[model samples]
Target: MIFNIENSDVKVEIPALKHYSSDLLSFNINKLEVNYTGNSNPSIPACVQCSHPAKPMPDSYIYYFEVKINSINSTRPSIVIGFTDESFMLNKVIGSSRKSFGLRSDGKLIHTAVQTMDYCPKFTQNDIIGCGIAFISQKIFFTRNGILIGKAFDFTENFPMFASATLSSPQDSVLFNFVGPFGFKLDEVLADEKKVFNNQVQEEKVDCRNIFYLVKEYLEYEGYPDTLQALEEHMDLKKTEPSNSGVISECYKSLDSSCQNCETQGKICNFCTKKIIETVEAKTNIQIPEPRNHYNSISLSSLYLKNTDFLKNPSKNSSEHNTKNLKQRGILRQIIITGNIKEAIKYLTEFFPEMLNDELCMLYLTMQEFIELIKSREIYKALDFGREKLAKFRNYTVYYRKNYDIPISVSHAFGIIAYKNPHESPLAAFLTWAQLDLTADLVNNRIMMRTQRPRSCLERVFKHFLCMENLYQETSFVKIF
Candidate 1:
């Protein structure tokens, strides 16, 4: 579902969130936090949106908000952020039901049973939590301050869910911040429901040193041994010993004992393998041989075939070949990208017959289905179906589509077309080879073979993130095709 984060004045009503309150309990906002005063008969519980299609929010549309526990009267007070289909009750805590899922303040996940306690950051008071409810993925996430405490809950049942909270003591209360003390740029906050199920959130340290391995992988894959060797020499890297590990990734294996890595408490040391490697290295000074000369490369332009071919040949045959090579019009590309399934399929049959095959058909059909949902304005079902379908292509051959003469990766391409009216703006005349040409050369090898396709890299994601350094930022949500 699309998010209108531009609305800053919106505030979640305290009454909607409270499922039940002790008759003596009173809730009020004090110092920017929701505060509750109760005379000790259990506590008050609350909810925000408790059903599918709650007002402006449609089913399966991801809803996000921030909550801060400003202060609690009890030292051992408990706080809960939970989801459930059941009605709120006075004495009930969120995880009391089999259908309900809850994340407790002490970092425990409570459903019918207490799962793990140490998985999340524990907070006492004055801490903010970024809470996200994703109906499409049927999962929830809680961010501690800014650090995203990943998927906290997954409820399989299709019943409507209400975002709920509970206070452990008469003194306990929590404030809802629909707007936020945001840790990340608003642009990075997820709005795309499709990315909810597939989205991977990782916090990795930026290292310029990693570029060396990236370049090494690139040169080896592209058959540029000479240039690679020159780079290694310039960088003063030691000539690596030829590996027996059979790994072709950026990281190489050391001859460290496998026992060191795999050993539990009492495994015996296996020194035989270590001894062999050491003895060989000591005696032979083992290293990969230097890269060879350029005799192997045969450029297509190198062969000179009687440079006067066009001069001698008749114009009639040449004209026919040129006509055969003519490209399909820009309009056909537009139709395919704009969700005109029937027309797009027709063009495919006439031009790219191969794209009408099973794989492409399945891809287009899925895209068409999602487009129908968008047209019908069924954001919930559209998000649900979209996630389920794209999950299959997790082990994707997205790179195969890099040969754009074929199609953009069906997953990425369809996403752009899904929201955009191909009839207008940038997409109307946007199939420029120059842009695709630059991207094709850069990221192709980096994809490699993977158990799962990665989300777009940060450089790619932030390329269109127009904001800079805090204060009244206006950033664009870019759907990269």
Candidate 2:
């Protein structure tokens, strides 16, 4: 009867050995050599395009060993194979029943049997051999019988086994033997490399001030500096041309003199001469008195006259006559300030011929009253006053242009006043006519246009007036009209 083993199904042929002894005979396995020539037939499906016909070893086939036994005795048989020290031993027993043993492709073993007699027989064999017990060609552990005997072989066709006399376990040293040449001194080598690296790091440190200075120099050479002081300093380093040198010299020469004009060879151009004229004129007019002078004069009496003896008898004292004239001038100035233009003009013509040149004073008083009339919407009064002033100034401008050869700026002032007056005033029409004649004179070289501020002021005022008129016309009152 054929009996299958416990684990692996390998077949074993057992022949009846009829020896009458109680000792079971063990097979001679010390020189056992099992040869595996690979699979007998190609295990992989045939691919017409493949260059090789057979499937390779380590994938297609596995080889292992098996054993079986039968006995006529009534007792059971047992077998054991294992390693002791550097040697291998196998022991076996036979009984009356059949027995079987199996060895898997993975190097494990299993057995099955039953006894039929009262006596037992035993047989054992060790050092059974085959190709190195391996799952893959590279993962082979070579053994003789059940004991490890040699190093694993490459088993790959072209590769040969490499040997080294200095085999060391991984735990034996600081570095693994697998790490080729620099393994032993790895820590020392790394420390040296790190030291050199730190030296490079120290060498790469740069002083910020030196870097900034170099950058500044480069920028100045390229004609741009980060700061105004750097730019000025760079410019100062450049060579000066003759013209620039001359200008500097002239500036220094001017600064050294007390008076720039005194450098000219004129006896009348002394600093004292300039000072004496200004002092005399300043004392004479005394119009815009200093704040301290005004404060001091605040306590003076408001009496109309201190002495009338000069009025009663002018020829008795020249100083008395001077006092009379001063009183008259004061009264005229009061009228001008009161914006009584007609009365002021009459008084000035009768008493003060020299004060007629006070155009700014007259213009100031006139503008104040005129602007009040405009705000009050007294259109007729504003037009009347504005027209009278425009006519007066226009005549004065013409007279100045014809007689003094000095261009008067009065026309522009008159134009501005007339333009600001109410629309009912014929003054703007008159101003336009007068401006045409003035413009012609200006073009013909008789009058200077620069002195005339009237044109721009008139244009602005007229445009504003026209805009107001349009707005008024759009209202309900105009719609009803």
Q: Write the per-residue lDDT of candidate 1 for residues 1-481, one digit (tens) a residue.
A: 9878897687745323433343534555332344455455444553333323221122224566667777665455367766666554545667777766677777777777555455575666778767676565666767787776677777676665565666565556677654344663333334444465355433345676456655544443322333444465567555443432222111213333344421331211123223333434344322221112222111111111111222133133223322221112222333333343444455546654544445534453445545545555676776787788855653443322223534344456445345545435233222333322222222222222111323233333344443442211222212310
After the best TM-score superposition of candidate 2, give how far the Cα of residue 211 lies from its true spot, in angstroms: 67
lDDT of 2 by residue, 1-481 (tens): 9766677777743222112111222222321111111222321110001111112122122112212212111121122221111111112211111222222212333223241211111322222322222223323332333334333322344232111011011111011111122112223323433455457677897776444344433322221212312333344433422111112111222222444433332211223232322433233211111112232121111102222222333322123334344444333333333333444455555655544455644453454445445545676887798787644655444312222233444455344344455344533322232332222232212111222222323345558989877864654323322
Off by over 4 Å in 1: 1-21, 29-34, 41-61, 113-116, 179-481
Question: Candidate 1 at 431: error in angstroms?
Answer: 36
Clashes of 1: 9
Q: Give the runs in model 2 whose Cα sits over 4 Å from its true position.
A: 1-303, 308-320, 343-377, 395-408, 418-481
Question: How many clashes show up per model?
Answer: 9, 13
lDDT score, candidate 1, position 140? 71
lDDT of each: 0.45, 0.30
TM-score per model over all chains:
0.34, 0.18
Residue 351 Cα positional deviation in candidate 1, in Å, after optimal superposition: 38
